[model samples]
Every structure is written in C-alpha cells, then in structure tokens.
Target: MRISRCVRWPAVVVAGALAATACGSFEGSTTSGSGSADNLTVSLQFTPRANYSLETDDAFVLSQVGCLETLVKYDAEAGALVPLLATEWVQTEPTAWDFTLRDGVKFQDGTDLTAAAVVASLQYLLQADAPPRAFTPKLITSVEALNDSTVRVRTPEPSALVPFRLASINTGILAPAAYTGTGIDPLSHCTGPYTPVAQTPAQSMTLEGNATYWGGNVPLKSVTARFIPEGATRATQVRTGESQIALGLPASTVPELEGDARIKVSSAFTPRTTGLYFNQSRAPFDNPDVRKAVQAAVDVESITSSVFGGQAHPAIGPFAPTEAWAPDSPPVNRNPDAARRLLTAAGYAPGQLKLTLLAYTERPEFADLAAVIQANLAEIGIDVSVQVSDYSAIEPSLLDGAYDLALLSRNHLTDIADPLGFLTADYSCGGGFNISQYCDPAIDAQLSAANTENDPQRRNAIYADVASQLQADAVTTFIAHEQTTAARLETIESFVDDPLARYAVTPDLTVSNS
Candidate 1:
C-alpha cells in the first residue's frame, strides 16, 4: 500500500493567516451510530442516481459499500486487471474469452458461485432496459457456461479490452435470486464481504458483514454508507465523529480536516479530468472556431490554484499526465487575444454571444470554477450565464444537447479502467454518454484502430493520436486532472484509498477501539 500525501499544509497556513479559525468546529451533527468500535459508518459523495440497479451506475454504490464483486478488478497501482471472482482468464480466440471462476466461492444467499450463475448475471445486464454503456449488445454477442467453473464470453468484434470491460462494476455477478420482476435486488444475493440489509432511497444503506465470505473472515461487523451529495456535509460528518470514513471531500474542507488530530486525510492522483464540455450539435459551439475560442479563454492554471487550492494538476488532455497512456505535451496556456480573434472569425461580435454554462452543485468547486470561467470568457467579449443544479437534474439536458456548455468531472477509468472505454463512450459518433455531442470521423477511425490493437504499446499510440485530435478540435477543454481525497478516522485500520473510486469497504477493513 503506497500512499501519496497531498502537499496542502502550506495552503492551510495561507488560509489560516487570511481567516483565523477558518476550520470551525462541527458540533450537533446527526451521527450514524453510537461510535461503536466494530460498527463503521462511511459518508459517500454520490447517492444512488438510479434505483440501486446493478445495470446502472448505481452498481458503483454497491461496490463502494463492499456489497458487489466483479469477475475481475482493476489494480490501479499495478495498472493491470487482477483476479476477483475469476481466478484466471485466457483469450481463447480473437473475439472470445474464457474465464475460470474461483472455486469454493459462495453468495451471501448461501448459493455456491458457478459458471451458470455468472452467465445468468451477465445475461441480465445484456437484456437490461438501458444496457451498460461499457459493453452493450454491439460489443458482446453471447455468454455461455462452458462448465460448472468456466464461463465463455463472445464478442461481436475482436476486443482486447474484454477483460477490462468485465471488470466494470455494472457487470458484477449476483445470485440468481437477485433478479426480480420489478428490478435487480442485491440484498443477500452478492458474493462480496458485506450483505446489504436495508436501504433508504437516495439517503443511506446498511450492510452486515458476510461471515461466510469466500475471501476470509470479514473484519468489520457492520457498515453503513450514508450518501450525502454535499461534500461539506460529508466532511463535517467525518470531522464530528458521525462517520468513520468520508469519500470525496471538497478541496475547501481539506484544510479544516487536516487540523483534526483524530482524522487522517489521504489524497492520490486519479484518472479523472474536470472539463467544460460544449454541445457541438448546437450553436455557437457548432462552429469549431467558437469551440476553440472558448477553449482559449479558459484559465486552467488559475482555477487549479484558486478553486482546487493547488490540490490538482492542470490537465494536458482528457487523460492525466501521470497516466501511462497520456501524451507527452506541454500544457495549453490561456490566450484571450487568440480567443477574441477566433470569435471574430466565427462571426461573433464583442458581447454578441450569450451562452449558458451549466454546473452541478454536487461538486462544490464547480460553482467556483464556473465563476472564474465566466469572468475569463467575459474578458473575450462572451457574455456567460451560469446555472447550478444537481447533476441528476442536469444530465438529461446534457445528454439531449439542450444546454450550451456544461462542467463535468468525469472519471475515464470508472466504466472500464482503460482509455478505450472513455474514448468510445464519450467521443464516438454514436457514443452513449457523449454529453459534448461531438463527432469527428477521423477521431472515430483512430479509436477503432486502438480497439483492435492488442499490443499495449501500439494501442497506446493509437489513443495518443486520438488525444491529440481531441485537443486540436477543442471538443472539450480539459480543466484539471483531479486527485481523489478521502478522510478517515485514525482508528480505522487497513483503510486503502482506491484511485479508481471503486471499492472502499473491504474484507480487511477494521476499526480499532484504542
């Protein structure tokens, strides 16, 4: 377990000097429990946007609470796919993969994990109302149980990323009983360390440790995950001892948490990028020059310093510079003069272009970042209006191209821990999650080439070309590569920070009374 500590103490000193006692005390907050040693409460950043469905992004909620397990898991540190429910896998053919399931594994429902069960779970996802964005029917064609211990998956095309696709939490295996007439019920039907017992819609969920977990004896007796969308509230819960662990603390709250002796704040660079996406299908962004002009107007360095408090690195592209696949290039500097010139070329006079910039309040820094961008764009004669709302309320408008510009914090590795998944789902002509409404045949061609290239170096080269094309087109102005910050009580032992933001509570996590 390597930990990368964030150098935020200097910023704390600066903050303290400006405002004395800025790190105010959090008292009288609602606590999760009586602060029991064996009982752990975690504050999560996102509530279940969907109805806790395994087929949607809500699967991540299940994984974070240790109630879901995928066949394979991404080892962010190792930068490779590792075994989870599946012990080993082999590419038997260009379009086919055979995964050997681990023996002696049992679902919390008391059913033994089998190849048939794995096939059933995947089949459920394939037949879902809105299939998983990672691997839909377009990608995967069939799933068959070769034996009691082996499952074979066949894709429509030769995909080297099949293993990584299976690693997505949306494909998490569950017992057959989980599939109900209404929807998938994960309670007591998963093969993870914890079994979800109760849930309050969009609020909180309670889970009890699976004593018969295949991995080993679960260390924590119980775990409760309270989904608080407000980052400050999550931080306050951890600070006031209402929660033992908190995920996704805003940068503004880090200094305050650092002042607490009982709390340990851990930060690590992740494969996430915060960017302002343009609705390419609509005007004035329909014009490439306008998109470029907006890109040139953004002051990424200032936003990184002021809003993130130097906690994040300015992004060079969609992928983080620290990632192996990221292109080796210089950061794009803001050029307001060029922005003015480009806007003129796009036939927009000074103060003629009025645009709406939408940002979600879930990420508190987004509001601050939007203000800075609004000011920057105004300098180049673009009049911008900002709208702040919950992400759930804005997603429909984003996907339908109803908005002009949107601020989004996207994790490239969340769907599949590879660049291909992000590239295909977010930039392709018919991308499922293409909020930008961007489409370029040249970039799509590069993505196709990367999808088929099995060789790691060659595949990365194709993606590098795609990244270059995306930047040149100004499809979205990548603001900064964010680092995930988590705060946990000092008493929590073996608390590992997942750079991928997948698994949080695990079998080895425990609490110490002393």
Candidate 2:
C-alpha cells in the first residue's frame, strides 16, 4: 500500500535534525516473503529537494526507492539504450518516434499505466520553472498516444537520440494524479518494484515491496532511506550497524573502513566532473586572458591527491578517462608566472582584482577544493573570498550571473546518453544551465550539428573537437574527475555503485543477516 503525505519545514530545521540524529534501528520489513534479510536502512548524501515532481535533483533518489520509472534505460557498459517501460521504439518520421510500452503495469494508485499517462508526465516536465528541469522537453514538439501501449514523441527537428533523453530521471513517467494544477504532487504514483509508504522531505522515507509489482518478487521486503549529508556520520552509521548501506562515503574514511572486517567499500568511476565555472558574463572573467590566467593558476594534482586523498583523477577534459571520448592529452601544468603575465595583459595588477568564489557543502570535498582553489589563486595575486552554502542557495546566484566563480561537481550523464548534452548546456549560448554564461558561436554550431548525427563514430569525432575548443578557450578550470565511493556492510550481497548514480538497490540486491 502507498501513502502520500506532505512534510513542509524550513531548511534550517532539516539540517539541524540531521545533525542531531544518530543511526538507530528503524522499522522492519513489512512484506511477507522469503529473503536473506527482511528490512534494510540506507543513507544518502543529499535529501530530496522540495517540489520533487518539478525538480530534477532528487529524481535519482526517487528512482532508487522504486517510486519512479523512465521510458528507457542507458546501459553505459554496452553503450546502448535498453528497454525499461519502453519495450521497443522505431522512428516513424524524421521528427517523430513511436514507442511500445510493456503492458499490465499498474501505478501504486491502481491506475492503469497508459500512453496518455506518459504524455502527461512528459508534458509537466517540459513546463518552464518545473522542479526537475530537463533539456529533453525543449527538443520535443508534441506527444500523442497512438494506442493503449504506444506513445509517439515528435521533436521540433530530426533527433536520432530521443530515446536517450527519455532515460533521464527528469522525464520519469508518473501517474496522472502526481501532476496537479499547481505542479507535480509528491506522491507515490509510480510503477516499480516498490512503492513509497511514507516520505519526510530531507529527513527519511519508507518504501515497501509492491505485492502486485510487475517485476518478480523484490529481494528485500522494505527499505528505509535516510538523507545523511555528513560522510563521516554516514561512515559511523554503517560501522555501528545503524544502517546496512551508505552512499557518498568520504575518501578520508575509506582507508580506515577498508581495514575493518565489518565494512566493505565499493566505488566506480561516475560521469561526474569537479571544476571551477568562470562566469564569463562578469568583468575580468569576461576577458579570455583572465579566464586562461585563472585556469593556469590552479594545481589539479593537489586537488586530486591531497584534497580527495587520492580517490579522484585530475580531469583531462569534461569527460573523464572512463568515458570513451576522453582526449589523450597531457595533464594541465600549473604555470604561475604565465598566469601573472596574462592577468597583467588583461589590465589587472597584483592585488587589484577581487572576486567572490561560491560553493556548496553538499559534497564535503567541494568545500575543501574551494579552499585549495582560493589559496592557489591567491599565489597568482588574485584575491578570492569563498562563500559556502547549500546548493539550492548558491544556484540562484550562479544563474543570475551574480557570482564571479563557482566550484561545482556536475554529472555529464545527467541529461542525455552522450556528452554533447552536457557540453551544450555548459558552453553554448542560451543554455538552460549555463551558470558560467560562456558562449562561442563556433562551439555552439559544432555541438548543434553533433546532436543530430546518428553515426556513433562521427558523433564522437564532433565531441572530441568541441572538447579541444573548450580546453583552448579555458572556459572553466577542470579540477578532477570523481569516482563515487559508498560504504556498505559485509552482510549485504551483490552490491555495486551505479555509474549513472541510480539503481543502487535493485531486484538483484540481497541481504544475509546471519
């Protein structure tokens, strides 16, 4: 059974509550079935941001709890789009594609999952100011339900990779009741293996196996997921048996926990990049010389080794070495003298330029990276004042062009399967998430062409060129490419970190209490 309730509170209160709470035994599994262990408690790095139906930040959490489903799934290893809700699809027209969904699936609300429901979910996501922002809706022209199991999506132009966009959590298909006149209602109107029983925003959530779940019997009966931002605290929780699984463990603790017999650490290279976003719309930063100066000032080696405790790799480009398109280039060398010369050329003298550096504390490494960057820039005569806050608080200033520089950890695979979506959003003019406000007509034209190119090899070549141009322009200082590390108990069987940062606890997961 699914129960939906709204829990509204100030962000301050949520933070305080999390800080005060320690790991403790919660409710047990409610589902009646044979499994190794009955119930499980998991810890996450970020809480679900408010207005989930509209916001994209917490969709991964929603999907992990089995409360949401996307039309397709991208198999990163295979480099292909596999079926999820969408069983098969074919391009009916140059601008349109028709999808055949798996039938007999029902939402937690008992509503028959239909093609119209898919259209409604997609429509709500396309609306401006929606909670979970998506670039997919911008490319789409219209959606129509051809039959009970078939839905057709038409783009403004011919798009060969439309299915990839549908795989994003931002486009998760929800029941009609989930969307209200105001926006998306935070309810468990999803079609998945489990349904949400109770949800407390930024606090905790409870999910139970859907007995009528279309998928086979869920391994674990129930799951209670908590949002614990502090990595050390999460490490403590998993170590103390307060939680069986913990996500977003700090690198500093990995050594300590890896030696322990009770704990196991699982990590993988995520399509996530840590970088400095230079606000090109602002003064000093607007000048290419200044941008290059700042890029050259930082020592990425220290960031990857000292700051991350050697858990991360120095970024060669937007795509990490894990990605096939990552360029075979030498590491960026720190040249303080050249940086000073460029600053002088850009009409800035030593100690003359002062700028604000913005960052958030969601990922603890970012705050540390910001401090290192602050120190690195200071050596080159640039005065930088760092402000640390929640991501929600910092994002507005970034989008409004109020910030001079932003230390951010962005996922390249968040939107579409290819890196082009990430490049276009960060480098192209009029990009929805262009907080840096960097734009180049040549870069934009090349990326626009790459978006529709069907051939994978040809598309990769285009992306390689775009990466080169962005690197030469020094649009932003690429810091490190991150690998997601999680702390898990030894009892948990078949544990793996999803490269996409979703699907942590799937039907494959099992637990052995003995």
Candidate 3:
C-alpha cells in the first residue's frame, strides 16, 4: 500500500486492545460525524505528497475523495472500460478516437462541461512541465474539440488502449477555471460528487457534496478525510468512532479489527508489489552478475511469512499472480550458495563489498523486510547497511540514483489498468520513474510492441515475455504481491472495495445513523 507521513510510531501491536494514546495525537482532531446520516469521516493512509498536484500521483487523492471525475473509469470486475463523464467512445481511426460527452453535465463551479472544457483539461495535462506517466505527448499527440459535446483524441502511434489510458486517475477532467498561470485550484472546479471546501495542507481536507452532481443526489452532505500515516492510528480512529472509514490498514492490525462488532474488515488481492530495486547506474550493481547475486541472496518466502503476516504472497514477477498477465512460473527459492558463486564470478570477494539498503517507514513492513534482507545478504558474505527514513526524504535520492539499493512498494496498474504503462514508465530506457536506473533495448522493444498490439492475447503474451526477461536479467527483486485491506463502520453502506485504490467516496455511498 502507498502511504505517507514523516513520523514513525513504535512497532505496531499485533492482536489486542491498542492503547489509544500510544498511537500518537493529531494536531487537529475532528469528530467522525456519525451522529448524522448526512455526514461521514474517513482516514486515509497517504497525505498529499505533491501538494495535490493533478499531474502527479496526488491526483489519486482527488479521485478517492470524490472531488475529481475522469472521462472513463475502468471496471476491473468486467475487465472493460465504462463511461463516466463521456457517454460513449468510438475509434474513428487506428490512432484517433472520438468521445461523446454526457448531456447536461456541469462542473461543481456551476459551469457547463463542454467539449472545450474537456479539450482544455487534457491539454493542460499534456503540456504539463512533468507530464503524467500514463499518457504523455509521447503517446497522445493532440486532443481537439470537434463540437460542443464531442472531442477527438489522436495518438502518435496506432493505439488500442486509449480508453484505458483515459480511465487513469491522472487523466481526471477538471473545469477550465481550475487551471491558472501558477497552479490548479480544484476547490469547486471539478465534476465529481464532492467539492473540496476546506483543507489543512498535510493534515486533512473537508469536502461538501455537490448538489448539481450529474450522477444524482449524493448520500452524504459532507465528508472529511484525515491524512494519517500510522496504520494503528487509522484503526483506532475507526474503532473509537472517530472515523467511519479507514483505508490502508496494516496487516498486523487486521486480527484486532476483525473482532470489533462495529467495524468490518475487508481485503482483496491487489496488483501491487514490494520490490528491492538496484540502481544499475551506480557501481557494483552496474554488473548484471552482481544484481543477480543480490536477487539470489534474499529470501522472499521468509519475508512474506514473517514481515507481512502471510497477508502477501511471494511475487514471481512484477504483476500479481492473480492478474491474467502474470507468468505461471513458480517462486524462486532462496539459494545462498548460488548467490556466493555469482558474487565470485562478479569479482567480489567475501566481505569485500559494502552497500546501503534504503527503506521508508510509511509501509510499516519495510523496516522488518530490510532487517531480514540484511541478514540474508550477510549470509552470502555481503555487507549491507540499512537506512530507514520517510518516503519523502528518500524519494529524491532514489530518483537521482544516489542510493545503492532501495525498497519500494509499487502498483503495476496505478498508471493504467494494464501493465503496459507500468512496464514502459518503470523499465524502459526513457522511463520517467525508472528508479532502477536500468535499461535494455530488448525490454524496450517488447514494451513498444505490447503498446501497439490490439489483440488482448498477443499483448498479454508480450507482457509475459518481458516479465521473463526482467527476471533473467535480475533487474529488480520482486518481493511479494500485497493484499489491500480497509476497515469501515458497519453502518457505512455501498462502500466500494476498489482493487485499484480509486473511487473511495461516490454518489451511492451512504452512512446510517441508527
């Protein structure tokens, strides 16, 4: 799970009554508003990492809080695209698609959602200083307003997944007024069911239901989302009735919450993986044999069992095993002997090489995982020093390739529902978020082919091949596939357990007072 906050709490208590005071205190605490059916309160794991920039991953906050709406939404269950703001879409040409906007849709700012607005919103994203990874100028060439209710999108190459690209939260549509010379102001310039009326930077955001929402009357009058990083605190908030909904609960807190009568715990296999990435741009890691040796040193099964409490399964590739694109290979067994041999082949003598393993505290499990990995590497005669810090502090160094190794939890489908976008943006030569700082022409070729392949079967086959290549290259050690878990008050109805971590608050959601 992607979580944030600079503070690191004491080790989480596994199964018992949590001392409410031990979870630490919030500066500005608010009631859950459970006394009234018209109000609701939610606790989220991540705070705004980029000050709620629509161009960055912060867009997900807008999406989950119901303050933003996209042209299309991905229905993971149906394995198909569904209309949201746009009523229907058709491919006019291999590289061009025409979308028909829903009639009478209005932004929360009381402005009409016209084709011009859609064009402007998309243009803003495309022309951003840091374009969204899901769809950039590299893939999308232009968006033109054909008429008052129609728009045409053209891509640089023949694309079959334009609809899927539009479904990404990063591609969410906003009113033209939201854009400014300095930055975006999404207070009332969105078309979603809720409108942000108040915020406290990294603390919390309060949203009021949009009366003119095109989806019909929203069930709640107001909603407050608190940004709490500690998983135990999030659980305590839900248990104490301070919040009705708590998302991103740590696995260790599940057993305790499951016993609560008022709270209902929900979990699902997600397309997220925790990985140990090597900065290939740096020293020893520049050698493929060294990377392979490190991969062989780590025990994935032990980490999954001891650190995650069995909430996660050993990952064989970047994609989750439950995902259709995942390869059917068995998990790699731990082999310290093989690791030592590889190190010898790579010209590294026992105890000759020393490296740093960076980890962030937001995920909670990273600390434990880091310790286990450090011990495992020691057995292979590798000296590893573990460094734990907040993700915010570690991000710059990770991106700059200043770190030797790092632990990262990534969602393969966050950019788009398909793994194609993830593969391209994370592993390709010019990938924007290539933390590994590793590149290969063969992998790039496979990703390029998958992007243009319209046939689902062929595209999936290409993805499997790329996965095999990545494993063979030992570009990164795929640790484990995570299971997303959340706890909510039983009184909250129509709660969506979205596997993609999108659309937490919606028009159908309701809170019962009795």
Which regions of candidate 2 fall more than 4 Å away from where they truly are? 1-36, 130-137
Q: Count the backbone clashes (under 3 Å) in each candidate.
A: 0, 5, 0
Better-scoring candidate (lDDT), 1 or 3: 1
Residue-wise C-alpha lDDT for candidate 1, range 338-390, written one tens digit per residue? 99999999999999999999999879899999999999999999999999988
Cα TM-score of candidate 3? 0.93
Candidate 2, residue 285: lDDT: 84
CA RMSD (A), model 2: 9.4
Q: What is the C-alpha RMSD of each candidate to the true structure, in Å?
A: 8.6, 9.4, 8.7
The parts of candidate 1 lying over 4 Å away from their true place are 1-31
Candidate 2, lDDT over the whole model: 0.75
lDDT of 1 at 251: 90
What TM-score would every model get versus the actual structure? 0.93, 0.91, 0.93
Q: What is the Cα-based lDDT of residue 418 in candidate 3?
A: 83
| Model 3 per-residue lDDT at 449 | 87
lDDT of 2 by residue, 418-440 (tens): 77668877778967788888878
